[model samples]
Target chain A: MESDKDNASLLGGKLSVINVGLDKFATELADHDVPVVHLDWKPPAGGDPKLAALLSKMGT
Target chain B: MDIIEKANEEAIRRMLGAEPVLINVVPAREIVPNLQDKMILHAGPPIEWDRMCGPMQGAIAGITVFEGWANDLNQAFTMAASGDIAFDANHHHDAVGPMTGMTTVSQPMLVVENKTTGNRAYCAINEGLGKVMRFGGNDAEVLNRLAWIRDVLGPAMGKALRDMGGIELKPLIARGLSMGDEMHQRNVACSGLVLRAIAAAMAKTSDDGTELSEALAFISANDQFHLNIAMAMGKAIMDPVRDIDGSSIVTAMSRNGTDFGIRVSGTGDEWFTAPVEMPEGLYFAGYTEADANPDMGDSTIVETIGLGGFAMGASPAVAGFVGAGAASEAANYTHRMSEICATENPEWTIPSMDYLGVPTGIDVRLVVDSGIAPTINTGIAHREPGIGQVGAGVVRAPMACFEQAVRRLAEKLGIS
Candidate 1:
């Protein structure tokens, strides 16, 4: 019962979030008065798996 | 740092340390090496006459007539089709030019020397605005203006530069950045600066008072007068950065009407190219997207060393002109570019970004990792030849070019 109350208190407190990949999630969270940071991330090597593997080999 | 990182650092170091100076203005035949008779040097990578887009074809015909190879445009077109004219990329001859970028033996060329490395590069003089050959307008009037530039302006400026002992471009470009000139689509500030640097010398050197006034008026009236000089400066600075082993940093980026091309430091002279993209932005009155041609020019050299769109934060006026949204959004472009570039240019900093340096030395690996291509600020020409500039705007270098470059670079370094 005490643990459940603690969980509820944690959920009720101010929330901050880090959004990766798509920025829409960050925008939505910020609209709800939440603090959020968005990272401009993309799949490496232009989403080409072979190129990504090559990039890894090159240690980029 | 690893081998690639160390090589790239060296490349950027050489690029940043370069000091390009405007040395002289002379005819293409006089200064540019291996420029043969009946040969025409054009922008972008090597392209055949049949593959050339409208503006290039139009410019070629105009230049043929200007060189007296043909009597009329129709004859010039037939000759161009007949294979009498030898065509080569300006880059092959240690030179560069703007849109259509046509340079025959007769036309005057601006020479810029990298003072530190003792290397030099060349570009043709910019014919001020509308109905000019650079935009592929060929008529009696265009030919007349070419003649005047060849006879009066070129000699006058050449004499002036020689008398004044050459203008240092680094400080001038720094001042231009502080002002609103991006040295690509917007060069108003640098144009005035060039005039200020050379006007007195031109006055003292010219024998004819009428010729001096006409040349001065032309320089003052043309807002992009310094663009060709800036291009030559870029070429001079970047040439020494080429051929550094293991460096994946892009040394050059250019576009013909049909294709865009880039050269990496590790890859040397080999060009990785893709189909060129059309620019999307605000158009002139009565012109729309329907009339715009694919982006074309050798001017992207500015971006290779970090200016133009990479320095967009410096010119909010260019932002609105190119339809890049509001003034506040300009710095965002620069910020985004920083993710793909190897480093920031300490000397060419943008004031609006708290004096943050312009992003410099494009790294192909970073571009593939981030999926952000270099943004280019450019003027849009008409789809059909002879119509001249229809608008100005921004476009991104194709991702495929960068991908191909990275793949080639990896193969070259034995990573594959």
Candidate 2:
């Protein structure tokens, strides 16, 4: 339990980034050795109901 | 690692230590060394007359008329075609200019010097907005404005600047950055600050009250009057970093309408070039993207020293000028650019970024590895000569240029 707490403190929890603009900001963070998850942002329907339904069915 | 580390440190140190002062305004022939009869200075990497773009050709024709070498455009063209004129890149003479970027001997230029290093750079006074020779407007009105700047405005400014001892720009740039100016696309704050700095001296130097007030009023109303001074300042700051062996930091970036080019610190005088790209943004009435010339100018020197697009986050007001209106969008451009930079400039900080400094010292390797190019906010000239500016927008340096710089640096350092 102490080790788990120490590990959590050491890592400082996951720091995620949603880069909706240029991909480089995330890349810079990554280059600095920070773990960053890039969120692929798109409008809810992808402007197409049929395509969004297909994506949802594929469990995306 | 040692060589690159040392060079990068030296580059950054000189860039940060730079204190550009607007010391004088003088005829280009008087200050620009080696400027002789029939010689013209143009922007970007060097090129031949045959390959010169339309606006450049127009500026040349207009300058010829202004110089009394030719009576009109037709005569100028004849002389140009017959090889009676000589042209050289402005970079060769330690100068930078906006669109069409013509600096002939008789033209007056604002002289900026880095007081710390004794290095200097020159740029023509900004001929604010429409129907100007810089954008290839060759009408009598254009020539008239140029003459007024040369005969009246330039002399008054020279006297005022000399009387005031000189105006330092770095502090104004820092203050302007804090107050809605990125010092390129938006210089309204800096212009006002510069006016306040020199107004008393300007008033004192003028022969009459009317002349003084007119000159002051012209600068007051023209928001872009500070741009050429800023370009000169950028050139002054970046010059000491040039030719630093093994450093990958970009020192100069410029474009002719035909080509885009950059000079890396380690690469010395060699230029890495790619075809120019058209800018994407808001156009003036009756003009569209089709009207824009490929991005052309030495104004990118602003971005080279970490202002303009690199400092976009600090000036959300300019976002609308480049299609993005949101403050978040502005911050995103700056944040994205940080990835390709060696370090954040310690001096120039952005208010929106929680006062984090703007990114400085563009690293070629990071640019290539991330496939991200440096962004520039610029005025788009009309594709044809003599049409002047059609709009303002954002553009990116070509990736190929960065890739080439990286390849050359690798070869120079004997690395794979």
Candidate 3:
């Protein structure tokens, strides 16, 4: 019962967020007065699985 | 650190330590080794006549006529197809050129020597804007200007350069960077600087007042006059960085109209290639994307040494001209470029980035790992021959070339 009350308190507190990959989520959060940071990210090796595997093999 | 990382550190060190100086201007045959009669050196990797793009073909024909090998463009085209004339890349001869990048035996070449390594490189004089041979203009007027450069301007500049004991390029380029020149699409500041450096020397060396006055006026009027000089400087600086055993740093990146190619330090002269991409930017009035040719030139050598687009933060004035978004966004381009490079150039720094060095020594492994290709600032030429420039813009070097380079490098090192 105490843990459940703690969870409710945590959920009600001021929110800050870190968004990665697509930035739409961060933009939406910012619109609602939430502090947010967006990280510009892309899949390694242009998202090519074979190239990514090769890169890993090369120990890059 | 690993062997690859150690080798890369050495390569970048040699590149930064290079001090390229403009020594003299002379005929191509006189300076470039093994440049034979009837041979034409062009930009990019080796390409056959049939695969040559319209602008390249046009430039070849123009050069043939300019050299008096053929009477007209039609005859020149037939001769080019007939195999009587030989063609090669400028890179094979330790030289570089812009646009179609035609370098024949008779054209005057600017000779730049790297004081650090005792290696040298060459390039042709930049023809003033409008219909010119570099962009495939082969008309009688173009031929007349070529004749003037070969007979008059070349000799005058050569004398002036020799008289002044050659100008050291490092400080000049550094000053230009601070004054809004990127040594690529925008060279106004550098051009004025070159004129200031040589004006008195040119006067002292010239016998004819009219010729000296015309030469001064010409240099002052053309904003991009310093680009060819900068190309030779880049080639001179980067040549000594080649052939390191385990280095994955890129030594060269260039494009023919059909293909874009890159050379890695570990791979020697072997080129990793992919289809070239078209540039996206603002077009001249009455022109659009359909009118533009795919990217082509050896001018990317400047970027290879971290001056052109990689230093975009230094010249916000070029941001709008190249269609690289708002001026305020220019520093972002540099910041992104930093993600893939081996190090930053301490000698050349951008003020807008709080005196941060320009990104230097492109690493093939980092490019593949991060999936960010090098951005190039370039002028758009007309797809059809002889139409000259249609626009200017920024383009991405294709990612496929970097992927291939990384694979080949890994294979060479016996990692896969």
Candidate 4:
């Protein structure tokens, strides 16, 4: 779960997504001079075990 | 001068030589190169519509009624099939028309001419949205509006145009290009400029206060009323370069809600065609996707030669209708379109283009070589009978049609 501060930071104003890996996953339109509302994907509960395991393997 | 000579002369001067001309708008029957398979001499016309959208059929029905050729829809279709009425394209005769581009013999149209080069261009008058013929809603009220345009608006505009000598559309398009307008969807600044220019004429030459008031009111009311002028400007700009020997530049693009078609310079006046699809976007309050028709209209000529959907970043409102993307998609569309064009509009420069000219002259060879056909921003009509404008969206011109046209033209030029 996102804290109110983090949610506000993402929602209330612009958040320039950092790093190429995340940028590739997210919509590439954020960098333009024009503004388009951004959509994000969040895992459920503690996190999806499958996704967590996959990420851990990638990190290794 | 003969219409063909006039058209060819005008087309070359403005398009190839890069000059401006006063475009002359006329009915398709009056100017077509040939009349084969035509229904009524319509603007950018002669669309045979078994494949047409439901709304287009409605407009054709209204046109039949307007012309006193038939009392009802069945009768109109029967008469059309029996070949009693002539159908023809406006561009086929050296003119252009708007959506549902029906031009009857009686309806007067705008005639923009370039005196220096003897080139001319044309377009029919605007039909205000709800229940209007252009949006493909046909009724008694629609016929009445057409009548009013014929009896009052057309003559009044012609008189005003004559009184003002000639309105230089280039300046307005140039200015609009800078102010977030690609001379297509968002024409606020240019439209306002046209109204103001016409208003000045209305102020000077009219003793009939109400007539002048009505004209001014009408012009001020519709944001897109200047689309006619832009069409005229586009014609003036592109008509000159047609039939330039081996040149591959495109001079025209128009759709009949059933099919989208284009004409390239190398092929003279031949139209290459493909099936049209509905634009992919949002709708006005009460409309839906089914309410929309496949993309239709002469407005595509704005982009065919560049400066409408090709320059979308210049018009944000268009993005709302055609799906959303940021400035780059819009800019990239312009840049991509540049790959297919031969030149840029010296006068109509897009601000987002980093002050570069609006891409001019669509080239079929480049389109085939690069694999990116132009995109259009358009209105969709209901697919079924009686429902009008459901939504608006964006769509691409099919690449197959361009490839076919290029193959044929290449064969003709021996470049294949």
Tens-place lDDT digits, model 1, residues B1-416: 28898999899999999999998999999889999999999999999999999989999999999999999999999999999999999988889999899888988899999999999999988898877888888888889999999999999999999999999999999999999888998999999999999999999999999999999999999999999998999999989989998898998999889999999999999999999998978999999999889999999999888889989999999999999899998899899889889899999988878999999999988888788999999988888887788899999999999989888988888887
In order, the Cα lDDT scores of the candidates are 0.91, 0.87, 0.90, 0.66
* Cα-based lDDT at residue B21, candidate 4: 38
- Give each candidate's fraction of reference contacts reproduced: 0.68, 0.00, 0.73, 0.00
The residue pairs in collision within model 2 are none
lDDT of 2 by residue, B172-288 (tens): 899999999998889999999999998999988888888787788889988999999999999999999999998889999999888899999999989999998888888999999
| Ranking 1 against 4 by lDDT, winner | 1
Question: Which scores greater on lDDT, model 1 or model 3?
Answer: 1
lDDT of 4 by residue, B1-416 (tens): 13223433444345645444333334434643453332554434346656556766777777887877798778876776666776676676555666777666666667766554677676777665556777776677778878877766666666667777767766667777777776666666777887777777666777678877887787788777777677766776677677766555677888877777888776878888888766787778877775667777777777865678877767765566566466456776777677666667666677765777767667665566555678777666666644556666777887767766766665675442
TM-score of 2: 0.88
lDDT of model 4 at position A23? 40
Which 10 residues in a row give candidate 4 chain B its minimum summed lDDT?
A: B1-10
Candidate 3 residue-wise lDDT at B206? 99
lDDT over C-alpha atoms for residue B346 of model 2: 76
Q: What tens digits encode model 3's per-residue C-alpha lDDT throughout B296-366?
A: 89999999989889989999999999999998988988898998899998878877778888899999988
TM of each candidate vs. truth: 0.95, 0.88, 0.95, 0.79
User: Looking at model 1 chain B, which ten-residue stretch has the lowest summed lDDT?
Assistant: B129-138
